[model samples]
Target: MAVGDPTVRTTPAVNETGEGTSTILQTRDLRKEFGGLTATDDVDLAVEESELRCLIGPNGAGKSTFLNLITGRLEPTAGSIYYDRFDITGLPSHERVDRGISMKFQVPSLYEEFTVRQNLRIPLQRAVESDVFEARTRELLDQFDLLTEIDEPATSLSHGQQQRLEIAMAMGLEPKLMLLDEPVAGLSVEETAEIADILQTIQAKEGVAFIVIEHDIDFVEMIADRVTVLDQGGIFTEGTIEEVTSNPDVKRIYLGEDD
Candidate 1:
């Protein structure tokens, strides 16, 4: 798909602000196994309210598996998952969504034949009061910079635009914490920066926490407030991007560096 599509996502300012230092999501010894193959290995993760945390590692490091476990796609083999005060260990995905958790996978999820506005309306229709549906739909359309494409079919949009649309749709559900997998994977560098900017804006204004599972080191560095590195089915280290990049173990063992 072409990257030149001009449907940039989001304009700044919804005039929203919030304050909190509580833990919104946490997992205690979270583990998932496929028979003898352990994918998520005793991961103890905590994402503070409104924090932007990124998980990055080489392929097969269990980043996706960890996401699945937290989102209720896979029941963990052992340990527990907690969201706020809820012990949501085995709750279904929709139940988690009702508790203000949502996820956007690497691929865009949109109604390909629907107009951009229609795509936004679908999720908003389900989440918002019926009297406010149209108003909220227009608000999201403007927020994602999709006002110009309000009438255009989603299938005709560039891949980058569709990614934005999908994310915007995810936001329509009013999630407190959103899990995004490789959100900028297919975009050009400029497009990457734009999406990162939009996310940062959302984080600051809406107090939304995001656990971004990504392998693009540069992209992770650009957007992550804090980072955790996973390796061979477990957390190898946790720190700021600078700290992780400079660690000799991370550099030599995973980052292909030789001393």
Candidate 2:
């Protein structure tokens, strides 16, 4: 499809003040380079409040580079990142988390030696008041459907269960924006569906925006409010799942089809 197809959505139009009123994250000319190679080109993107946006691309297309830049794992060589209307391009990763930005890497980050209850308490202890910490931990456990295994060691649970525990811990922070890198990377179909349901429910009830980098097309269709395709280190196209999936250019570039 043509780049400007009316049915296909592109970047949001910046207001006179240079930010969308509803946008939770915005990047201007975001770029990253290492040695002689440019991993991310000048890419301008915006994610709105409570939006479930998916980022997909072929390997070496710069999806990881862009995510690292947003989460402050890697500082951009050029451009600025704005979160909640403030410039956060130079902030450190931990500061970003403290400021309501959280990430769940592909590998689950759980305390393997701790019980489910103990793992959940790690983040809640730091964020919730002691008076309500126990109650809040229970709430998160129930939400993630881990109440039954609350006392089980992390290493004893199935892989999917461990993934759930990590997510529950991240939610303890009450983040405004959640960055998930291949959240359903390794799991049975049933487990993947459960993750999709949990994400949708949380977004609906909590109003947290999500920027997910995933290769699972089915899961992307299941959770994405919008889809962004990255190619050659920049945005190739973006639109609703249907519009993006049907675009000939996207299919050719993303699926490696040749004329």
The C-alpha lDDT values of all candidates are 0.85, 0.87
What lDDT does candidate 1 reach at residue 224? 89
Can you write out model 1's per-residue Cα lDDT over 130-218, one digit (the tens) per residue?
89987888788788888789899999898888888888988998999999999888889988888899899999999999999887788
Candidate with the greatest lDDT versus the true structure: 2
- Report the Cα lDDT for candidate 1: 0.85
lDDT of 2 by residue, 18-134 (tens): 342888888889999899898899998988899999999999889988988988999999998888856888999988988898888876788889999998888787677889987
In order, what is each prediction's RMSD in angstroms? Answer: 11.8, 7.1
Question: Which parts of model 1 have CA positions greater than 4 angstroms off?
Answer: 1-21
